[model samples]
Target chain A: MHRTLHPLTSLCFILFFFVIALFGAPTTQMVGVMILLSAASSIRKRKQAWKKIALYILPIGILLFLVNSAFGAPFSRGLAYALRFVLLITPLVIVLLGGSPTDFRLGLRTVPIPSRLHYLFIFSFEIIQSLRDVFQAVYIGQQLRGYNANRSLGNKWKNIFPLLLPVMLIAISQGLDRSLAFEFKGIESPAEKIYLRTLTLSPFDKLSIAILLLSSLGLIVASFILP
Target chain B: MITIKDLSFRYKQEARNSFEHISLHLQDGQALGVIGPSQAGKTTFAYALAGLLQKHFRGGSLTGTVIFDAQDQAPGTSEIGFVFQDASLQLSGVTETVEEEIAFSLEQFGVPRDIMRERIEEQLSTFHLIGLRYRHPKTLSGGETQMLAIASEAAKHPRLFILDEPTQALDADHVRHLIDFLRVAKRSSTIIFIEQNMSATFELCNHVLFLENGRQQFLGTPHDLLNSNIDVSSLTLPELIDVQRSLGRNHISLLFKETIEWMKKCRTSA
Candidate 1:
């Protein structure tokens, strides 16, 4: 669905879920949405998406719970705060799992944004993606070199510096290289930009957007009316 | 014509210049091969020729002029295409597929969709990327990525091309393709070809610039660079040249066929 749907439709879907997660009441509705998103990810064969969401949600969620409880908040309040964290992050991870930088740029192009801003947004995502790959490679290299970060908590803490320094240096070098490449490609040329593969809303894309919009409105209304 | 006069550059806080006192004149549609050992400022020379040393390298002092057709045009204004040594870094990550990657530059130039399509099709076929047109750029192998990088730049048909070790990642077959492409490219574009592969330098370039320790060692034809008394021990000379030197032959054959014929004569006489 992500591959076939119009970028605008996907953008709307992502935005709708984000809004719901942000403002929708901390009730079964939010949980339902989270479950639905995870299910969507599963159906799309992004099996690792939910696991990645969990990996992030668990530690931070527990930390939030502990902090709230330590501050004398009720158990239910602490749990709700933790659930809010989960709700906040799921949409972002879902988007990351399904969308590439190109999709983000294409989606942003539908808005009346400046081209420079468009490049900023796209390059930010590109850098993040590049850094992710760099981090993975560095981590594997460290592991192969017997500096196992998983051996113990102490080792994990100790390995952070070695892993981080190279990644940062490589990221900086790559950033410079990417900027030079952009210039070489005439990315900032004064000529008006054009798209070879133009985006068009298909019937399914329209239907998806409509359903998302209605669902979002229903969620907002239900949030106001519900206890 | 592309002309550089007494060009020199020093990186920020560096003790010595990267390369200095370099000058060369290359006619239009001529290819110049830049050869040097590691840290010999070959890439610096390339960046300078592409008009990137001043713009991209902040705080780096660059002296002298690089004029294109007798005009000192601002960077990115002229059609100066550069292919960096690291092919992966050359990719515009905003493009998803190989075909879009080729079109990314054309789109930036605002080429009409029809012409853009024609150029994209031509590049895909020329670079032998038709089968991988829809594949994501990140998923390509090193050689394929290098080809894609070259193809994307080649699609622009720039007036001047600055390629830094463009064949480093390519296999033999792809290297041949690149040589063929460059052979055609140099007919219409002034090319600054920086390569460590001596055979490629001999095959593609009419002029050669040799640098060492931030200074020009020699600047002339490939044949002269090999035949001259200057020290070329740092470079990996082609096997044929090494064999010629070992056999105490003063004359060097630049063509492989001619060299093979000479070897046949020597064997028959023996």
Candidate 2:
């Protein structure tokens, strides 16, 4: 809910949620706590709540639930596993859309981590984003150019590969090209860097991070105590 | 100024050279339009100029010399700003906003805070990007993204700027603005423009590099190539040039408006 927190603080909070979801027992208490966090995020941006649920969170959760149950896991356990996925993913969605994108690399850079690792993180992230854009662009371009009065699910399904192959090929080539541009911009240089705005965590950021830590620890302890 | 002599290159495991025995001298403060059809090695040539061919593009037998700033620099260096064909891919993935995108390289170079702020402001206004300064580059229109890419590179103020088909995704108005920007840029930096839009290229570039099938077919002024009896329909020749070739009209126009005005004059005179 605190949108103006330092990007690094936001990152810490998101990572805390992820670690909790990944490692914590799938008890009612853990799920309830994560649900509260997600609900707060959704309530903050009510307009995007439906889209986050329908497009990303719910479908993935449902798919995982189905897979787990099909593999002979008990119904309750499968449901908990699915809920955990949703919980872990919620923090990232909340933070990205809640405010301006975190200066993620800079946030990571402020730590004792080496520059090259952050560089790799930033470069790889961009490449993935670029590839996604290429695929989307190809799909949109195909739809616009091949504007036919198609009225069948079968036709739409069949049309997918025709668009996908070119997108894949273009994405691959562009990825390689971008790697070259990455070095061209002297990103590989070991030069001292300056940011447009250096990140300085406020007292509020520290408080938020502290609260996130306590909450995560409390949920873990509560998970064990609940049963 | 740059001199590239006896340049010939082929990609790894490829049987043929993309371009062979190509040689040209780019003068200071000149815009040379590099035009060719598909698969004519325009992108390859652009890369070579940028100095990427040496290390970035691996396992290629590249011979000859590319001398810029009195040094044999690589394509991806600071001296030669090569705007890739796809502006979207070339974007520094770290920046969240258009302002950040423009400031990205400046930050990398550790440019002083005061100067960086001044440069970002100037670029935003110059490219008509003031309105979209806070907007993310990924969400920008095709033309706006392209302009932002150019502005980002221009802020670095490279000695030689080579753009590979920058106008491909742009509309007429954006293309006009880009050309106008290039006109001013040509006063300071030598520009190697790889473009498909012949008329626009002709409008901005004085020297032309016309390639056909991985070879240099013609290297001269636009007027020289236009006046020559070369039959290439795929190339987007201006209507004025076509009329000049057919009729005895000596009219010169690289734009539709100019062509229309010339036609009216010719009709009235007749």
lDDT (Cα, 0-100) at A219 in candidate 1: 81
Q: Give a tens-digit lDDT track for model 1, residues B125-200.
A: 9889999999999999999999999999998988888899998999999999999999999999988899999989
lDDT of each: 0.83, 0.78
* Candidate 2 lDDT by residue in tens digits, B5-43: 988899999888998888888888999998888998888
Residues A7-36 of candidate 2 have per-residue lDDT tens digits of: 767777687777677656666436655564
Query: Considering summed lDDT, which 10 consecutive residues are worst modelled in model 1 chain A?
Result: A36-45
Chain A TM-score for model 1, please?
0.61
Residue A25, model 1: Cα distance from true site in angstroms: 10
Q: CAPRI band of model 2?
A: acceptable
Candidate 2 ranges with C-alpha deviation above 4 Å: A1-3, A7-100, A103-106, A114-116, A119-167, A206-227, B73-76, B229-234, B249-270
DockQ of each: 0.58, 0.46
